[model samples]
Target: MPDIVEQHGVPVLVCEADGVSIGTVQDALDHLIGAAFTGAEVVAVPSPRLDDRFFDLSTGLAGDILQKFANYRLRLVVIGDIGRHLAASSALPDLVREANRGQDIWFLPDLDALADRLGPDGAGRKTG
Candidate 1:
């Protein structure tokens, strides 16, 4: 099970590094449910949990999965290094840059970044 903790008063479900990898849309939904059950407003998934296909813009898997999170009204933060995947795709860098600029989803480098995004009062940048 993932750990549930509060960051600046916001509930966050931090996915374990050794947990099941998310290679499909179903996998993303499963995690969303996990967040809901934990009463988490945000789900922080480790980079290893994401399959390589998620980083491949051509696969469309990332969009499908992230949509589930947004539709469920939960925030998602993919934590870790995606430098290699970014190097392989032309459009992914743009996507990451755009996502980080938004609230519902973010591609952050670490947990500290997550805290910063959550902000001092947990309202984040744009609010939910």
Candidate 2:
């Protein structure tokens, strides 16, 4: 189950911390759409539910998943400590850094970090 919470005044669908990794792009899409249906402007997914391949740029899984979210004009936030993956691969750290710098997608250390990024008013205003 997921939680629909107001973060920084924005509605965000926060995925469960369950350790079930998303194995395919379809699964990712399902989650995104489901979140959107709940009127969430941003979908916050815990890192524990992401497949290991998602952390490997060469697999292209991350790109595919991100594209789907972008196509729907939904913001995707991957939260949790991905330090192990980052240390294992140089590209992953770079990718996370780049994503965090953008508004469309972000990879944050935790929910608090996300709240900080969203600021005092969340992502400016609420969205459907």
Candidate 3:
């Protein structure tokens, strides 16, 4: 049972897995909401290794993970080397690209990139 850490005073849940389950999301939401989270932002799941399979955001365990996020309005970030994913399916590549463009879902290359993009350092670094 991992606990959420306060990153810059924001509750951040570092997912130590391929993807998160509904139970995990519920627990996280409970923690954040209990801490008075405004639902505007949330912890990012820092991982390059996602649950097996992609494209269809329905059925299977991966779908369960996606559905949980979709239902909770929770922002998700899959930070890692997704080149393998890109090579596997064009739909996944497109999904990743589209998700990266949105504020809620992101497929970043790494944690530094995520930190820099989120401006967590308060240095006002430009997000590329």
What TM value does model 2 have?
A: 0.88
- Model 3, residue 111: distance off in Å is 1.6
Q: Model 1, 100: alpha-carbon shift in Å?
A: 0.5
Tell me, by TM-score, which candidate is best: 1
lDDT of 3 by residue, 1-128 (tens): 33454445444555555444333434444543233243334545545334444433433544555566667756666667767657866467777767676666677776666666566653322245
User: Residues 12-110, candidate 2, lDDT per residue (tens digit)?
Assistant: 888888834686898887765555677888888889889989998899999999888888878888899888899999899888887777787888889
Q: Where is model 3 more than 4 Å wrong at Cα?
A: 1-3, 6-9, 17-41, 46-49, 55-64, 120-128
Alpha-carbon lDDT, every model: 0.85, 0.80, 0.53
TM-score of each: 0.92, 0.88, 0.60
The lDDT leader among the candidates is 1
Please give the TM-score that candidate 3 achieves against the real structure.
0.60
Q: Count the backbone clashes (under 3 Å) in each candidate.
A: 0, 1, 0
Candidate 1: minimum summed lDDT over ten consecutive residues — where? 119-128
Error of 3 at 124 (Å): 12
